[model samples]
Target: MVALTDEEKAMRDGRDGDAVAAAMDLLIRYADALGAEQLCETRNVAGTNTQPSPAKTKLFEEGGWSKAFSVISLDCDDDIEVPQMKVPTCQLQHGFGNDALGIMPYSERNIELQAGAESFYSSKGVNVLATCTPYQVGNLPTYGEHIAWMESSAVVYANSVLGARTNCEGGASTGSASITGRIPCWGNHLVENRYGTHLIESGLRMTGFQDWGMFGYFVGDMVQEARPVMIGDLGQPDLADLKHFGAAAASSGGVEMYHIPGRTPDAPTLEAAFGGAAPPESLHYGEAERRAIYDSLNSIGNSEDVDFVLIGCPHASLEQIGRVARALEGRTLSAGTELWVMTPRALRAVSDRNGWTATIERAGGRVLTDSCPAMSRVAPAGTKVFATDSAKQAHYLPAILGIEAWFGTTEECVEAAVTGRWRGSLAPAAVVR
Candidate 1:
């Protein structure tokens, strides 16, 4: 029942090419599965998850790269070369870092497979950004533009922070949308679906990124999948605060977009955010709730001789990098501990140019790019305890890396990185309730 354009119909009928036909067929099926009545053109950007699987590469060598592309990306069994992407597309972060950095180790075959995957996508006209925060680089989309982005934190950032429209699309669907330049018209694509469904009146006066993050964790739990309109005297949070908030919310729950009246672009006014209607549900977050959320995120108890401290989950911005540099300027990491700061390569270059990278490196830390501990599964091998400022990382790394995770403020994490001890307290430093 999904309607298609004439060009799309032609491609469906195999007039464009086998690859186009296969991609179109897959998209049509996906639209049908979503119960969408029609397809709409994506106006702004499209991105695919960086998929560099050694198993998939072995399949490619056994069969062919075309078959692998068809089965893996297009979700079809047909053998066809992947057609050039129709819109501006970029690749999200994968499990590997850059060839030169070599921060995370990989086998010879795995490296070759990663290179082959990059080459294949690059040849098919995809800008392999290799980082999750493509917006920080060059793939910036303006307000209200439609994009097909797959990474969870990036999707939330794009919708809530950038005001661009995108759902929590999976890798396959985003890849199909990239090739066809269209996606099923549903779920955040329409203006009616973007309005706030819940109202959150925050009573706690948040001071730093950790406070905002803890508030977001509570709100995400309260609202679940519903969009929330936050009203408070938060006093204009910066980009890093919003980044931590969005990342934590997206991880703890399924929040794709949130509205902070007078802060975010879409929510200029409270009335505008709610679409002139009052929210049916309301929640209050105060000092006690913030402390509880912070304690819940920090699962480690008693034995907290820190082994590793990770700084970025959504990849640190230049400002965040500068903060980390300033914290560790005159200090060195503990003898038994390590610090790894992950950021996008573009921002890493900026850090390098600004001497922040050298400052951290001189302090016995590394500014890594493209991959994190959870993504690459590369820790210091004997790491028993890990600490991070990211609630998202704290939630996932324990299960992924099989270690106790301690979550706290950036300064507290820096202290752990310096002294190799968990001196973080769950109580709020100063609460205005």
Candidate 2:
């Protein structure tokens, strides 16, 4: 077992008094849980916020979280008006309740709980903006710097794309890291730990949204439990495609880290990401593989029955939103259908200013920000049948909602929403014999 240092011991034992002391205590325990050898100071955290549970509330009153929460910056906050979910409780050992789950059943009591929780963090000076992309905020720690992040896309982006280091974090560990300004020097921190273990060779010329998302799921499915460095004759994929792949891979096979050769920073070339270690396995991805991946992940059905259609899982990029607006031109969604396009709130505002939001809304789609069906757990609860373009959403909805969710291309989802039934083919053209 990795041992905590004297400073960590004092903090855990509450010898340092309040505020910073309480925060350090949590960080030490979190590091200990991960068997981390030492702490790395963290400058940022990205995740959702919730109402304080009984233990957390008590701690706030008696300990220093009340003070610590006042100063930290949180990427997102929980809302009582949105849908609620039953999730494994996060940091603070908050009990499993709507308050802890940060879901909506917003009676006056629940509202009070939500407010009380917000007050604790608000009093601590944490930014209460409801968002997932904190890198958009400001002064993001540069590549190779240590960060603590919980949002899947941000974690991958920081590690694989931006060249920063962090592990797949939780809210509790994040909060603890924020308080102590340090995280265990583990996972992505070590240079040796960042090397790729799996090799992905792509034959398809993947460029657009659907292709990218499907390709990501393909790679993720094939490279389970391995860090993949994608290498091939593949051309540059857009940021939307990267987001789609990262989110899908994370959702599908627990791939919190991946390096795209020539695109990602750390892996300027395949050789560097590998660091001289030979890949244990190499998988080839082609049109057939993409179609097969889509077939495997996608529910085979033409029956629409879709009550909801969601487009953004990792938050739509500006270009993706523009494409959506262009595709939906002059088309109206079915009156009964609910369509949501999610993006980072800041980006959403930019779209709103540029008239992309209106264009999408005019075509019967509403744009939401900082939250999605997966994180918000909103659409899945009341929804019987769900439709999304993201493999991540498709993969998680079944486990999270206990409902059958269908994965399709954005066009397929849009057409389904318009017709109140699936109008797309069960098999992609690449898969038909």
Pick by lDDT: which candidate is best? 1
For candidate 1, the per-residue lDDT at 185 reads 82
- TM-scores of the models, in the order given: 0.95, 0.80
Write candidate 1's Cα lDDT for 6-125 as tens digits. Answer: 988997898868877777888789889888888778845555544556656666887766667777777877667677777778888776545424444445556566677778778887
What are the candidates' C-alpha RMSDs? Answer: 1.9, 7.0
For each candidate, the alpha-carbon lDDT, in order, equals 0.81, 0.65
Alpha-carbon lDDT of model 2: 0.65
lDDT of 2 by residue, 130-223 (tens): 4455555342558898877777766776787788998988765666565555678888888888899888877666656777777777777777
> Given candidate 2, what's the lDDT at residue 400?
64
Ten residues in a row with the worst lDDT in model 1?
97-106
| Clash pairs for candidate 2 | 19-64, 69-124, 70-123, 70-124, 70-125, 71-124, 84-103, 91-172, 304-421, 304-422
Worst 10 residues of 2 by lDDT: 78-87
